[model samples]
Target chain A: MSFSVDTGEIFGYLGPNGAGKTTTLRVLLGLLSPTSGTAIVLDADLSKDDSMRRRVGVLMENNGLYDRLTARENLEYYARLYEVNRPGNRVTELLDFVGLTERAGDMVGNFSTGMKRKLGIARAILHEPEILFLDEPTSGLDPEAQHMVRELILRLSRVESMTVFLNSHNLDEVQRICSRVAILHQGRIRALDSIQHLTSAGKKTGFSITLADTTQASEAEDLLSSFGGIGEITRNGNVLGMMLVTIHAHEVVTTLVKNGIWVEEARIQKRSLEEIYLDVMRQAEGDVA
Target chain B: MSRIMVVAEKEVRQLIKSRNVMLSALLFVGVFGIFTVPAVLSGMGDTGAMMDTLGFYLVLTLGVFMGYLFTAQVFLREKQSGVIETLLCTPLSLRELWFGKVLGVTIPGAILAYFSAILIMVTGSAFTGQTLVPSLPVLFHIIVVIPAFIAATSGLIGFTQFILGMRENQILNFVIIFGIIFLTTFIRELTGPEFSVTWTVVAAAFGLALLLILVTAWLTRFLSRERIITTLSE
Candidate 1:
């Protein structure tokens, strides 16, 4: 329900539909007043201070574009609203950045959804705001377009040094780009931590081993099942996948080789963001029940 | 001031680019301006007086109608499309946005009103053997007072649209259309053909328009970002 984004951090907000993600975003952007709590950004209340909004940029689900206007014109309109200096150059630079330079003069209504989203991103960052809030930025985009958007978000954080609060259902995108994330379920934050800590939070480590043949994998699985600290062992062809609780990867590899089970490869898998998100949702639902 | 101008400028540009709306407005004015002049003139005894009367009431009606048409586009269209949420995030104050849109609607509405005046005059002159020109007061009304009325009308409509929900706005829109029609008929009946255009009448209309504008501007204090944003989904 409450959190703060550090400067220049790409904080991902993950939630399912109807989890009040957009509602929280609206309150923070000053489009809606909170009923009982404060939503602050940059040490100023955006709802009260008009000047403070000049330093912030936002791209909501709608993209806030005039379809009648050209792509360049849409950016220029926002650029002027933000009082950005040299709006012409700034707009052109952003058009290139979002890869819409060739279509700058074309009407936005004619653009594809990906093109519109790209143009929306360019419009949001045209003024070089200190912070940018993007709601479902890559929703409905193709894989290639999604990659471009994720890369762009990273570049904005790393190059422009702009703090980003990204709200998305794309867990892979968040895992690939965000430094920290908060998972919201039924209007409450169930999990909030860095990607590293959250993925490695539990004691059980996912470990996988590939052997030379199916017979060797079967033998290894049986051997590992007999041992303590290893559970949920499943064998497919020459690979043995399991979760290591009290055991270590080095011990497993040494034991396998000593037992004459040839080890082709061994990998320690980290928990994915999708797994963490589902866990949080399950816990929240359990609490509700 | 600059931000207000920016918003105003964007609205004007969008209005101009709306080809279908522009064409419909032109057709509406053309029908009333050209087709109705002969019938109204034939019923009046004084040609100059008839020209003044037509220029006065007809142009003012057309101007306010233009305000109505364009206010929906400039004000309600943004709300309907959810772009107003983003605009609210800008540094522009609520008054500035309302005023900017008012000016945006007024400029084009006044221009159309001027065109209507010329069409009425030209059509009346063609029907009659003599050149028909409005008197000094009527010209002043066309040049000055009509735009003020347009601003006033659009300003009030835009303000209501910002504060009201979609269903209420739809109802309000119906009221506006019928109200404009009723006012036009009522004023025509009240004035009769004996009504004359005078400096006093023009000044009084101008005063009323200015008052409406001031009142609308004052009413904007009640506008809140939360109110506008909350109504957007509806």
Candidate 2:
């Protein structure tokens, strides 16, 4: 049992293309039975307790949609399969959410790739599932469609507090949206952590002092770099950036004022998610090699 | 329960859209109408010789072609289109999927077979110059045996479709359709002549149908995200 996720989360499962993301989704959806390990979904082992799938939703990368059926019909078919409580209302809501209310009558075969994917999402969430497994939620989609999908997911996550297990190779998307991320490389988790703790590694914990002019910035940089605790001081435009490698960040006020550089603003460089993801993958590759 | 039916119904609807299947069904029915129906009507002809020589030729050649297409392309289309990936991630088991597919083809195939049989009877009667009313037993045989033939053929088709990966290459599908036809005859001979073609086919159909159900159940034991992921990573 997981110690966390009880409070709800959008956990991103990051990996390269063809990294078994689809296969993992299959197992979660109970389409495929695992040979050895126990599959626990929604606190129940899928192998033993088959009923758990009823509470879970899955949007696989490929839509096994009935191409002959209209979009509305496709959703209706899945809605019945998932045993949705309010079939008509759910269908309407899903169609509207996916922005397919206009094309509800069109056959799935006629819908564009993105439209089909949106329909897939609608089908996945129609059952009001407690958990959703979305494999590459925005892959192959246009930028506009990608934004729509992202916004919809954020809305759903915030409002429903739904546990979303998103699998994707898009690192940027993962970094921007995921509250927590797990990197899977070659059938194992390379790393799993929150965004904040991951990027704060091997860096001076100090604030930057913003000056009004580049002349002030260069002077400040020279003065700060000379100080004993300040390791490396650089000037970015009017900003005096210093890496106080040894001293605590709180000591910046005293160090700056003593150096005669009046500080207008103080801030630290926050690490980006891409930086952490690359670091973890590099570590994993090194360890494996 | 409802999901399986939805899947099966959708498959049936797709049949209407397939120009290839429609053309194949029409060609097969037309051949039945042209050759056998005429021969049966001409009772002046030798019935035994026809059943022995021409009938076997027809059933083996055309039946195999039809059977192969029924099994191979039916599911292969969905697989190639990447649709199988969608439903496989559902709560549905493989057993239900197989049944839905079998029915999807069997219903339409059976209807086609039934009409072909009607042409056979009408032509046979006209040729014989007598009321060739089949007895109740024969009628029962026709009803039971004909559907069984189609069902069994569809089952055989399903196995080949799965084994051959019929979805991608149309050339492979042609090779498989003919290959299974020849193999069915070979497998039949190995089982022995005491079981005639009808019995052999019937038994084989029913038996293979049962085997398909089992294979599906067993294969599912290893299916999961691991399989897809492992495959992709490789």
Candidate 3:
């Protein structure tokens, strides 16, 4: 679980529910004193002094806004807590950034879950913190809202050049934006690497070939067998299945046609992140079967 | 400009915006309106003048209101709304957090106490045709009494609520608050102590404040922290 987050890069802290994700963030924020081990954030010993929290933006799932205050008031309150000067303009900028400008005067109690989530993010980033820690940030957001949140994170990282440490149980959500991911289980690090490195190491690509007839299919299969990196080819009716190899997918089709096998269709199969996550978890549990 | 100052200001503004704050202010004012008549009658026969008698009664009024409002909102709202978690996440030191809350809640509360005192002075002046003598004793009464009352009320309310489970043990807390307020009033009325020994009252106020603080700390150390961590774990 010891890794560094580079500035301007998105890092996903992937783990199971209650796998110490929130606890880890809390320690980093200096809200919790670690029982053992160290949480070093921005060169400060988080356990010793929490003054660094002023430079960090954090959004917790279901951490509701003060229901009695307007959206503007809530932002102003956090800005003040972070000691941001001239909080009024910062409040306006954050409201606009979250598309909450129109609802700035409205009580946050009346807002929808998605709107509240957006506002929570706005409050966190109001002071332009150097790092952002978002825990299950898009838990209940719809697809479009999730996309907007992702885009917002990207914008913040690129424009502000901030480091983001994201904690989520959603793997696809991680893959969509994270430059790197660390998988955790049972209070230990199971896997830590860039997505490209891990996928290439532990996973095999898969593809389904849909052809016209058995003669063409057999011919394609024979050609594909000699074509380096096809694993366990299977056939039924006019369909063909194989685990793809280290070689680029286009190389396979080019090799097929050169061998006089008419090309009908070739597609590299996709593995869902959920499947990969399950595989990683099962491996951690010593239950490959 | 400082983080603690920001948090303190926000807390004060929040207390002001709540309906509970308005009602508490109005209740203290209503007490002044009612106490003013009797205060003036006492002043008509006084050698010391209206302001001195009015000042003592103002202290009494402030004490009761402080005891009541300190419990109703500051203790109840944070417990109910779940905002306490977010507040604790700030970089505010624990000492700063505690003092900030006490100050924020008490400032408006002190202003309300002063409002009642002014009402008493005005009514005493108008009804008895006696101008208030704003002397050193009158100043002493306000400076000592208003803050003592505020501190005592905060101690009583905050300690009981944070320790006894303000959200869960409603009946137990209500009984405790009722008993404390009732006993304090009953004892003060019976003591009939002289004004010069006012430090005795201050001592008693501080004693109550310290007890509340001790109970809050013990609960956090022995019980509340584990409960919060376990609940979040689940």
Candidate 4:
């Protein structure tokens, strides 16, 4: 329910459907007033200072574009609204940045969903705002387009030193681009931390080793069962997958080989952001129950 | 350009591109301007006064109707499309948005009103077998008072569109359309053959329109970004 994104940080607001992600963004952008408390941005309450909005850029679910207007006109209109210096040049620069310069004169009504989404992002950063708020920025985009948007967000943060507030349900996208994230469920924040800390926090690494012999698989499991630093050793056919708490994959292989068990293949499996996110949601749900 | 002019210029361009609304405004003016001239000529003892009164009130009436038609395109369409949500985030205040739209609707509405005046002059001369030009007062009314009335009416209607919900706005539109038609016809019937168009009447009408503009501009204080954003279509 509450967090602060540091300057030049790509803060991901991750949540399930109806988790108040969009509502939080709206409150911060001054589209909706908070019921009891205030939401501030840029050292000023957005609801109180109208001029502060000029410093922020927003791209909502609707993209805030006119279909009747051409792609060039759409960006030009916003450029003028934000009062970007040399609006004509900025519009052309953005069109090239989003790779829509070829279709600049085409009506936005005829644009595909991905094209429109790209244009929406172009419009959001038209003025090179200090902070950008994007809601599901990559929703309905193809893999290539999604990658392009992620790269653009990274470039904006690294090159422009612009802070980004991204609201998305795409955990993989968040994992790739967001430096930190807050997972919300049922109108409350269940977890908030850096990607590195949350993914590595208290979770043991997993490994699956393929034994050369079916008979050695059970022996491998039995040996690892009493192992001091390993947990949850399971055997399926010739494969032994287990959780490694303190032992390394190399140590597990050496221990098996020293016991006369031939190890065919050993692979390490790290916990993903998706697993952490789902686990947090389940715990939050259990608390409510 | 100033933010108000930016918004106003965009509205004007977009409304001009809206073919259906433009054709309807032109059709409304053409039909009433050409057909009603004969009706006024049939009931008049003084042809000049009859032409003058028709020019004065009819232009204002048509101007208001045109404003009504264009207001929906400028105000309601933006809300329905949910574009106003982003606009609310801009540096422009609510008053600037309202005034810009009022200016946008007035430009086209006044142009159509001027066309209607010319149609009346042509059709009235044809019907009476003599040319009739409106007096100086009537000319002033057509040029000045009609555009001011158009701006006033557009501002009021656009304000109501922003404040009210969708279903309530639909009902309000019906009431406004019928009210404008009834008032235009009722005022003509009330004038009868003894009515005289004077400088005082022209000045009084301009004064009333100016008052309406000021009142509507002041009432924009009640409009909030939250209200418009919440009322916007999802």
Which candidate gets the maximum lDDT versus the true structure?
Answer: 1
Report the candidate with higher DockQ, 3 versus 4: 4
lDDT tens per residue, model 3, A92-188: 9889989999999998889988888899989878778788888998899898888888888888888888889999998888988888888887767
Using alpha carbons, what is the TM-score of model 1?
0.98
User: Between candidates 2 and 4, which one is better according to lDDT?
Assistant: 4
lDDT of 4 by residue, A86-148 (tens): 999999998998899999999899999889988998998898889999999999899998998
Can you tell me the CAPRI class of model 4?
Answer: medium
* lDDT by residue (tens digit), candidate 1, A1-289: 7898999999999999999888889999888888888999999889889999988999999889999999999999999888899999999899999989999999999999999999989988887889999999999999998988989999999999999999989899899999999999888888889999999889999999989766777778888889999979987888889999999999999999999999999999999999999988988999999
Give fnat of each prediction, in order: 0.91, 0.47, 0.49, 0.76
- Candidate 2, residues B1-234, lDDT tens digits: the string is 566686667667777667788788778777765575464334424443333222323333344345446655566666666666655555665556666777777677766655555555566556656544544433433455445555665665564444443333466656666676686567435434232235444455455545655565465444443333222211
DockQ order of candidates, best first?
A: 1, 4, 3, 2
- lDDT for position B120 in model 3: 67
User: How good is the docking of model 1, by CAPRI class?
Assistant: high
Question: Candidate 3 DockQ category?
Answer: acceptable
- Estimate, for each residue in B1-234, the C-alpha lDDT of model 1 and write its tens digit: 388899889999999999988998899999989987888888989999989988989999999999999999999999999988888888888988998899899999999999999999999988998899899999999999999999999999999999999999999999999999998998788669668988999999999999999998999999999999888863
List, for all models, the DockQ compared with the true complex.
Answer: 0.89, 0.37, 0.40, 0.79
Best by DockQ: 1
Who is ahead in TM-score, 1 or 4? 1
